[model samples]
Target: MTNMSAAAAGPNATYNFKVVLLGEGCVGKTSLLLRYIEDKFNDKHLTTLQATFLNKKININGKRINLAIWDTAGQEKFHALGPIYYRNSNGAILVYDITDEDSFGKVKNWVKELRKMLGSEIVLIIAGNKIDLEHERTVPLEEAESYANMVGAKHFYTSAKLNQGVEELFLELTQEMVERFEQNSQTDLNRTQRVLVVDDEAPVQSSCCTGSKTN
Candidate 1:
């Protein structure tokens, strides 16, 4: 629920989205986040204790959007708390290491949990990370992409070390969230208009009945 916008946002940022990062430990969830938000990468692996929050602002087309990203701990001990971070998220990035088949399986479990807890309305993206070590990859691109398609999620191969597809992934999710928000708003407006039309007709029908009775 914290807002993160650039100083230049001023009044242009009309859309705000809460995005959560989920993955197995050492899958580079934190690395991917840092690459997108800070544009920095470290070779050392550091385990997240609980969860970290970051706020970043970006412009999509002509509209400004703020992304509040939550990086959660990937350790098994913290698995039970995943809902605390992702519950009400506008979008989720489910990451897995390309070199680790086990991590990919973990990603699938996370997807199931998110869907069960947050429902299908949450925008999901499957990220096959550590693509920089493609030579050591155990999970094939075709396999990952196929799973993503089956689950109706976007798929991207990213390497936080090389800063590949990190920005594009976030931007795509942000745009999707904005489009969904606008669509929902329009639907509400249309429903209100329909109700008003019905109300207007009700009064006309009453007046017509009164006139007929007088005749």
Candidate 2:
């Protein structure tokens, strides 16, 4: 956990986290993000460029959480740029088209890369998107859930077209992030207290050493 991504605690942001969305092209990553960020969706296929950045503020448990979200281009040619976007990200959402098995396969590769770069401390969410097309689904729900469990991620079935499960997914993610932030904050406080205790005892130890020298 030494290299864990730290949530930003700033004047304007009570708790700030960077979140990255990863998946193969046409997996509804952008759609899911748009639905979450703006509650809006387009039926037309939207291709991101290098990436798109957005800042969202939400209040969870009476504390404001600022989310820095980055939606990256999912095209094969832009795959190399993934690291640049996901580096130091506190959370990642791996979106897969439930109708496309290959999209789910690509999500696995993305998951491997994210864990390699960000490690286990980074919150991971696996989204089986396009559930509105359930009739066309090729990715089994059990399989996705099992894989998510194996990797310590939460799995969700989402449909941006129907605006279903989008809000719930973000709410779950926000709560998890808030819990992590509180835990991290407590750890830091404990570490600081330990250091202060050591510092206060330093002079006493030095005085005892001086007395020993005099004797």
Candidate 3:
């Protein structure tokens, strides 16, 4: 659970964090992850047997952050196994297909269970995936944004096919996680200055496909 600590030691420290993706089957959780981590997406739908794992590294404001991402099986049968993968997660990405209203409801369930287990210790990021199919969108932008706000989760629209909002989604999540982690352990002298600077940065806003952010 070391990585789940979200710890970044004194000077030149690297923040290590664990992230997991959860949602109903075929919600494009895998596709969105592929787009973020590998910058590749397969048009063909491939069923995930159990789970997939990947690592991503990014530098933010002179601080190094490493993310261990766990892509879990979205099948209902695997619902009981959710705790196994998300147990020590520092952050979670709950994805729901924009075309499937049921998937969005399921994401709410995941949020409940996650809060029961991890409380507010874990960061939450919700994504309304498949923006390319906006014409067929059943999930209203207002509803998604409202729900995200209600649950204290940042929301964004992502399209794996168009590679839209993918980078922004991850970047925002990473920045938020780093800020939270830094605040939790700001007792170190070296981190004091970094914390002050982070506090003055603009508050992250929900992003749309055009990279536009909302207040």
- Counting clashing residue pairs in each candidate, in order, gives 0, 0, 0
Off by over 4 Å in 1: 1-13, 199-215
Q: Which structure among the candidates has the greatest lDDT?
A: 3
Worst 10 residues of 1 by lDDT: 1-10
Per-residue CA lDDT of candidate 2, range 117-161, in tens?
A: 767768889999999899998998899999999999999999999
The RMSD (Cα, Å) of candidate 3 is 16.6
**Candidate 1 — what's its lDDT?**
0.86
lDDT for each of the candidates? 0.86, 0.85, 0.87
Q: Model 3 lDDT vs. the true structure?
A: 0.87
Which one wins by lDDT: 2 or 3?
3
Q: What is residue 78's positional error in candidate 1, in angstroms?
A: 0.6
Rank by TM-score, highest first: 2, 1, 3
Question: Which candidate model has the greater lDDT, 1 or 3?
Answer: 3
Which residue pairs in model 3 clash with each other? none
Number of clashing residue pairs, candidate 2: 0
On a 0 to 1 TM-score scale, where does candidate 1 land against the true structure?
0.86
Model 3 segments beyond 4 Å from truth? 1-9, 187-215
